[model samples]
Target chain A: MDQRPPDHITAAPSLAAKPPIVTLDGVSKAYANGTVALRDVNLSIGRAQFVSLLGPSGCGKSTLLRLIAGLGDLTGGRIDWPGSAKASDGTPKRDLGFVFQEPTLMPWANVFDNVYLPLKLGRLSRKQARPRIMDALAMVGLEKFERSYPRELSGGMKMRVSIARALITRPSVLLMDEPFAALDEITRFRLNDDLLRLWAGRDWTVIFVTHSVYESVYLSNRIVVMGARPGRITADLAIDAPYPRSEAFRMIPAYNEYCRMVSAELHATMGEASPE
Target chain B: MSTSAEPVAQRADRRLIALRIALPILVGVVFLGTWQILVTWLQVPKFVLPAPSLIATAFVDDFASLMGSLWFTLTVTVEAFILAVVGGVALAVLFSQSEIVATALFPYAVILQVTPVVSIAPLIIIWVGYDNVRVALLILAWIVAFFPVLSNTTLGLRSTDHNLRNLMQLYGASRWRILTEVQFPSALPYLLAGMKISGGLSLIGAVVAEFVAGSGASTGLAWRIIEAGNRLDIPRMFAALALLSVLGIAIFGVLSAFEYLMLRHWHESAVRREN
Candidate 1:
């Protein structure tokens, strides 16, 4: 009761107030099969903001995330990394992290080796990258399991290793596509908390894709609810929840309110998607 | 109940292990015993159907020459196996790198694999010449052993997890790094499996090639079997055949052990699962 919420913990600041790190202008993606995955997705992500692309399965949230990561080419549009110090060939920023729906750890490699991948690709010697790799693993509390292979770890542990691997590069942007969807409830809740802690302690921009309204409500400062059948942004709601959010936050009325708002928007989108 | 059942489970495990060893030996004994008994009871001629005891005696009697021939066959088999593995894996890596090259070369590999070694042995001997008959045999063995490694490894390399491939791409991994770090490790189990099949095939190829070469060239175990047959030394022929079978088993066992050593840590196929 003595603690106060942070001043910035209000609605997402307007574009004018916050400096944009990346801008997606008229971004449209059409598959070779004539499927319009995303259409004219005009959005600007501010630096270090926790943004969630919340939608149903077919809403192309994952597609949008992939676009940002430069894993696939956009049919028509441009992504600009404004004020980026690094090279811009319209490829994924070299220092960005990506976590797929699966843990995506190499089955052959132990946790340490898996975490070392990005650094290894960066041409850092194993000995040189060892300290940073250890630090990243320690961040995810997987320091002890460094020698354990992916098959030996539990589902949640594998995901943690994945997160650790992503963080190893100290990436400015972390793009995750339904990373916790495969996990059980308890593990998912714990990971959500852990992810928030990591995010709070760092200045990393996160673009998380998920269909879960509750998850979107709990983690994100701004939730961009997307609609299918063309796949365009339907609503952008900001949850003004304070951080250092604990298990107690789930009990608060505001949390439920945010969840309800997201769910309603999602339901409306789904309704519009299907007609009798 | 859990505490009490623990000992029972341990006992059952021990019993299972014992059975695993015992059952195979028991089957072998019964099989040999029936063969010995039937040969004795029917008063069968040794040339037509040698008894187990006669075969054992003949094996010892012809041990020196048989051992030499066995060594010759083994050397050829091992050399051919090594060549197959090297050639197959190299070609597979090349195929994985270029779709056009793979499209051009893959059909010939398939053709080589589908063609029986028996049919090819005579032509190989003629082309390779009697002076280099062993080289002809080696070539034939290599042909038999190469295809599985190529096909399996190609499938495995191509089957690198899409997500992992995307992850590597996200990291801006070089194609070489992607191959060494991701594709190679993924293909290892498949390559090992192919090697296991190739091990047995290599031995068979060596034996078949030697059989076709017949009488004149290097006297391998297959040639010894042919010689024994011509002279009505049926027991010696049986002994040589037994040695060939043992060599095949030994090759398979060695390859399987290699596979286990390589993959036991990570691969689901090699990892121990709890029931």
Candidate 2:
């Protein structure tokens, strides 16, 4: 393995904050069609840690995220919450925010209503959610687009709204599934920076899924590179760099070095899959 | 997108709108002119087909009698339409909930529609007697026109965005709330489109039933058409036909306008794009 620090590796923040709050044990997933998507995978996520599930396509990264969110039931294994583990928490997994590959917004709804959907569905009335919705919209830099419909929005803005919706719930664990893959390069870059800033500010545990190595390196503190064809974890690279990452960091030699290493790893992973 | 020709563009747009409005009127005038020429030139027998001017004169001369029949027809059409809407939607909601029952009864609805109104109107008139015969006839007409609306609306409800449906489910929206907020709103355009089609259909049904009624009940435009035909008032018959045609067009136009207004904000179908 290459030893150079990732160019976009964020600076190590003070660890006095917290330890990992989430634990998964022997998580094996098999579809109804007898296709095994994940097998005996184990992962533990820390509080406020941004973990990128970096992998080739069909890595079951998204499925794993869904299992965590309680959107999907695991065929085997258990997701344990240390502090809040209980049988009687009436609050559903909907409280856990999920950003899908597509924005998955209600096309009929305006930005404000779409942002407020979760909260409103949680039994909060429109009046109660007005300020919170506005705040979320502002968090995503879409303050001026409250009345705009999804069809009118650009892909980046729509994804931002999705992010805002995920954030609006103040979710402890945010699940993202390649939300920015559809965007152009420039838009993706800006969104990446915005995402990091937001992640830093909120201190929420984020489990992100992406096929892009540069993206995984840029935003993740821990990159979980996965392999497909009956998905399995191949590598987990920890990113140790400084925070408040700027556009300048992407240009540094270290950043390029990390990109090359990840690219090589990805290329090798693809080659290995071809023969099998 | 340039601002320089904005006002000029605005003028051109308004002119375009005016032309769109004028084109239909121009077409109608031309159509009437051709019809009048054909009748006059061919010396088509007046009893068979009267000229437009003759029809107009007959309409004015028999205004009092025609007005009474028109009122009756209008009432039946309105009543039948209202019943169709209220009953169709209620049944649709019921049917949407139970797939088994919906499947069982949907074929029956089709059977009801396919069974000719003439065959049923006479039976209904006899069963209900004279005073309520017209209403019975109207109901017969309505049943046929209503099935499309119900089926279309239910399909629309069923076809709502899966993401939105999941979102609602995640939020733990109650069945009633989901139905009202998501399913119903999504179904509105489809329901309205069906209504536009059924509006004209219901009118025709009412008229046909009235024609079948002969003279026992004078409820719809069909009776007037029959009366004029029986009396050999050819121009009066044309006048009645014209009124029926205009009424059908007007009903459809009204429903379409309502659809446009309702969907203007939310649906792409109703959204007007800049020229």
Q: Per-residue CA lDDT of candidate 2, range B90-111, in tens?
A: 8888787789988999888888
Q: Which ten residues in a row have the lowest lDDT in candidate 1 chain A?
A: A1-10
Model 1 is docked with a DockQ of: 0.82
Q: What is the C-alpha lDDT profile of model 2 across A1-276, one tens digit per residue? A: 444545455333332135656778999999999999998887777877888888877888888877776666889988777755453664433346778888888767899988987887677899999999898899889999999988788999999999999888788888888989999999999999998888886767888999998888788777777777778777666676567777888888766666666666665666642211
> Model 2 compared with the native: what TM-score?
0.88
Deviation in Å, model 2, residue A222 alpha carbon: 1.8
Off by over 4 Å in 1: A1-16, A88-92, A271-276, B1-15
Candidate topping TM-score? 1
lDDT of 1 by residue, B39-135 (tens): 9999999999999999999999989999999999999999999999999999999999999999999999999999999999999899989999999
